[model samples]
Target: MIAHSVEDPLYYLHNFRQVLQWVEQRYADLLDDQELAFLQAFVALEQSAQALMVRMVMRKGELFRSDRLDYAEIGDTVRALQPLQALGWVREPEQLSLDQLFALLRKDELAHGFAGQLSRPRAAKSDLFAQLQGLALAPRPLAQWFEQAPVGILQWCLQPLCDRMRLLFFGNLYQDWSDFVLADLGVLRFEQVPFSPGSRALQQRSEVDLAMALHHCTERLEQGEAPAAILDALAQWRSDNPWLARRHGRLLFALGRHCERLGDWDLALTVYGRSNHAQARIRQVRVLERCERWAQAHELAVQLAAAPANALEVQALQRMLPRLARKLGGPAQPRRRTTAPQLIELELPRELAELGVEEAVRQHLAQAGAEVHYVENTLLNSLFGLLCWDAIFAPVPGAFFHPFQAAPQDLHDADFQLRRAALFDACLGRLDDGTHRQAILDCFATKHGLQSPFVFWSMLDQALLEQALACLPPAHLKQCFLRLLQDIRNNRAGMPDLIQFWPEQGSYRMIEVKGPGDRLQDNQLRWLEFCAEHHLPVAVCHVRWGGPA
Candidate 1:
C-alpha cells in the first residue's frame, strides 16, 4: 500500500519505477533486454514531459480563473501514453501478465528514440508524436512487439468503418455501433489473418476481443441508447449464446423494460414475472403498476407490506404503497414533513441554531421531571404524530391521544400501546408527510420483542399489515418479513435510515407525517406524485380539531 502521509510526486514515481522493474526483470523474460531498456527510456521521457506539463498547468491555473485548461492538459498528457495499449504489448495471450506487459511497454517507450524526440528541438517533422498531436493521440499497441493491436483500438476503428459500410449499403444503420462493436469484440472464434488491415478481414473476431465489445453494449444501454435497440441486442445474445439461467433472467429484466416502453406490456410483464427472485417479483409489480394494472399491483404491494418489517424489504414495500394507493385513486393530498417542512425551514437546522426541533423536544422532555420516558426514536415519535394528526384532522375528530403523546401512568402504558396500535390501524391507507413515513421506517429499523406472528404487526399499523397480508403471495411475504426481523435484530445501533432507504429498493414511495403547524415540502409533494403514478396509496391525514381539508 502506498504511504498515506506521502504527498510528493517522486514517491509515486519511485513506486511506478519499482513496479515496472520488478514486473519486467524479476517476474519474466517477456521483453528482450534491449526492448525493455528502450521501454524504460520512453517512460522516463514521458514522465519528464508530464512534470513540465503539470507545472505549466499549475501556472496557467494561477493566471486564469478557469481550471478547465489545467484539467484538459493533464488528461490529454496521461491519455497520450495509451496505458491499455501498452499492457497489450508484452502480454502473452497464453501466459499474459498485465503488469509484465506494461513494464515492457514502459521500457521500450523510455528508450533512445523517445528521449531523442523530447531532447531534440521541436521541428516540423511527420513523426509519430506530431501525428499523434495533430488530430489524435498515439495508437496504443496490443503488445510490446505483438503484430495485432489492442482489441479496443481495433473496435474503435472498426466501428466507423462498419458504419460507413452500413451507410453505403443500408438506408441508415439499423442499430448503433454498440451491438456490432460488442459482437466484433466478443467474437468467440475467428480465422487468423496474415497482416490484413481491411474491414472484411476484421469481420471474424475472437470472444476475448468481444469482451470489450459487450462492455461497450452495456455502456451504450446505460448511456440511454434506444431501449428497443438495447433489448433487441440483449435478446439476440440470450437466444444465440449459452448463458446461465440466472444471468439470462437478469438480462431479460433489462430487456423487458425496453419492451415496456415499446408498448409491449405483455412482454414486460412476462419477463419481470418469470424470474423467481424477490427482486423480480417487485419489478414485476412495478411493470404491472406502470400498465395501471391496479389489482395486481395492489396484491403485490400488500404482500410486501405484510411480509415483515425488515428495514430493506419494508422499505421496498413502503415505496410501493403510495403508488398502489394512487392507482386506487387515493385523493391528491399535500406533502408534509415534520422535519424540514419548508424551504425556509430546510435551512433552519444548519443556520438557525435555536430552531433545532429535536433538541427542543429533548429539552422539553428533560424538564418534565417524569421518571418514565419514551424512546427518543424518531420513528416512534412520527408514528405518534401520524396518530395525532389522524385524530385531530379526521372529518369527525376523536379526543384520545396516543399514550406516547405524553407521560403515561405505569398502569396505562399497556393500554396506551393497544390504543396507539389501533390509531395506526384507523389511518391504515392514509398518507402523511415525512414524519409518519419516517416512523414506519424506524419501527422496521429496530427489532420487535418477538419474531414470528407479531413481527410485521409490531412494525406497522394494523390496516397496512392486513393490506400487505391480503396482497402478497404467502411465501414471499414470509421471506420479506423474516428478513426485516433479522436486520433489526442484527444491527441494533447503526446509521438510521437516511438518504438511502435500502439497496435496490431505493426507488419507492417515501411519506412524511407532520402536525397542524406543519406543511408539506415540494420534494415531498413530488414524491407523492411519484407514488401516485406508481399506483401506491397515499393518505395525508391532518389531525386538526377542524374538519378534513
Candidate 2:
C-alpha cells in the first residue's frame, strides 16, 4: 500500500515508482543483491497504474474504489514484509501479486516523480497541469480525491491552481472559457474573489474583457434589472479601484445610460456629478433636459460654460433652453428698475473713488466666477450697469440663466430717463405724433437697434402690444406711454407710411406683420407693448413668401 493523498491515480502510481527507485538506491549497499531484487520486484507492483492485482482483482482495479480497502488494512499488508511491499511503502495483501510487482518496477522512475523533483526548490512549481493531464487519461475512477477534502478547502486549492494554469498556458486565447466555467459552477464567490488579475491585467493591453463586461451589463439592464442597483454595485467597486481613466469614463457613462432608461433623472444627475469629464457632464445634463428639469439642466449648462466652454455643452444648452422656456411659460419677465437719489456728478467717497466702478465690476466678475450667469443683466450688454445698480436682488434656486433674482422696484430718476430714451427710439417711424419730433426719435432708434428700450413708445400704441409691456413695472412706463400717445395724436410727432391713427382710441399705431416664431427685440418690444396698451387693433399676419396669403 502506498501511503499518500491520491489526487490523481496515475500520477500517484508514478510517484510511487520514483519513491521505490529511491528506496532501492538508498539500500543498495546495505542490502544483498537478493534484497535489492526483492525491492525491485515490489516496485513492479506499481504496474503502469493499469496492470496490477488492484486492477485485476477489484473488477476494474481502481484505487480507493470502495471503503473496504481501508488505510489501516492496506498498511497492515505493506508492513507484513510481503515481497511486493517494503521500506516506507505500504501494501495490501488481498489485491497484490507477483506479476503486478514485476510490471510496475520495470517502468522508468522519472515519469512518476517529475512534479516532485522539478518543484523541489519551489513549491509553487508543483505541476498541477501535469497532474490534471494524468488524471484525465486514467481509465479508472478516482472519486475519492474529490471527496477527501472539504468543499471549501478543495476550492481553495483548486481555484488559484486552475487560474494559474489557465493564465499561464491559455493566456488571452481562452480567457472567457475559464471565467464562464467558473461562473456557471456557482464557484465564484463574487464578493471574496480577488479581483482576478488575469483579465484585469490583460485589460491594459486589450480591453476585450472589459468591453464584454460593459456589453453584458447593458444586456442585463435591457432585460430589466433595476439600473440603480447595478450602478450602485459598480460604484462601490469603482470607488477605490484604480482603473484606466478612459475605461472608467466609459463605465460611468454606461451607468448614466441605465439611469436614463429608467427615467430616474435624479439618480442620473448624481452619477454624472461624480464623473470628472465634461462629456459625461453633458450627457447628464441631457437626461435632466429630457426630464424637463430645465432649471437644473440650464444650471449645469451655465456652470460648464462658465468654467470652460465645452462646445458640446454649449450647443446642448442652447437647444434645450428654448424648449424649456416654452414649457416653463417662456422666459422670465425683466424686473422693474429701482431708483436712487439724483446725482449730477460723482460726489465720490474716498473709498469709492479709490475703487472705481469699472474696477469694482471687474473684481466682482472675477470673484464670482460661476460657470453660468444667472442674472438677465449679465445676458445683455447695455442693461448690465443699469440692472446692477437698480434691480432689487434676491437669489432663487432653479434660476439657472439669471443667478440674481430681481423683484419689482420703483425706478430711479436716471432709470426713468433711460427708459424714456428707449421708448422714444422704438417709437420713431412707428409713432404718428410725439415730442422731440421725428429727428430726435430717429437718432435714438437708429443708434440703438430693435431691442433697445427707447423703442417702447411706438410699440405701445399698436393694438395689444402695449398691454404686454404695461404688464411689466416701474409705473412710469405707463405714464411715459400715455404722455407719448397724447403727443403723437396732438400733431407733436411725424406719421410714417406704416403709421395710422385709430380714431376710436385716439392713438397712432403701426401695422405689424407678426406671428409665432417672430420675436420682438428690446426696442421693437416697446412699440408692440404701446400698441397693445392703447387698444390699437393691429393685425398680426404671418405670410410665407412663396405661398398664397
Top of the candidates by TM-score: 1
lDDT per residue, candidate 1, 320-343, as tens digits? 777677768887434333222211
Candidate lDDT (C-alpha), each: 0.37, 0.36
* Stretches > 4 Å off in candidate 1: 3-6, 10-215, 235-264, 274-278, 294-353, 368-549
Which ten-residue region of model 1 has the weakest summed lDDT? Answer: 396-405
What C-alpha lDDT does candidate 1 achieve relative to the native structure? 0.37
TM-score of 1: 0.32
Report RMSD (Å) for each prediction in the order shown.
21.8, 33.2
lDDT (Cα, 0-100) at 478 in candidate 2: 37
Clashes of each: 69, 59
Per-residue lDDT over 1-549 for candidate 2, one digit per residue giving the tens place of the 0 to 100 score: 122334344333343344335333432343345445545555454443212223222222222222233333235422333432333222332332223222232122222323343333222323433443444432321232223321111001112222222232222222422222222222211111122223232323133334335445555666777767767655643322223333445556667777887788888887777655436777876887788787877677667657643323444455565665566677753433322211112122234324543332223333543111111111111222112211111111111111011211112111222334544344332333332233332433343322222233222222233322222222323333443333222211211113233334434333333222554343333434444554443332232222222
TM-score of candidate 2 versus the correct structure, residues matched by position:
0.25
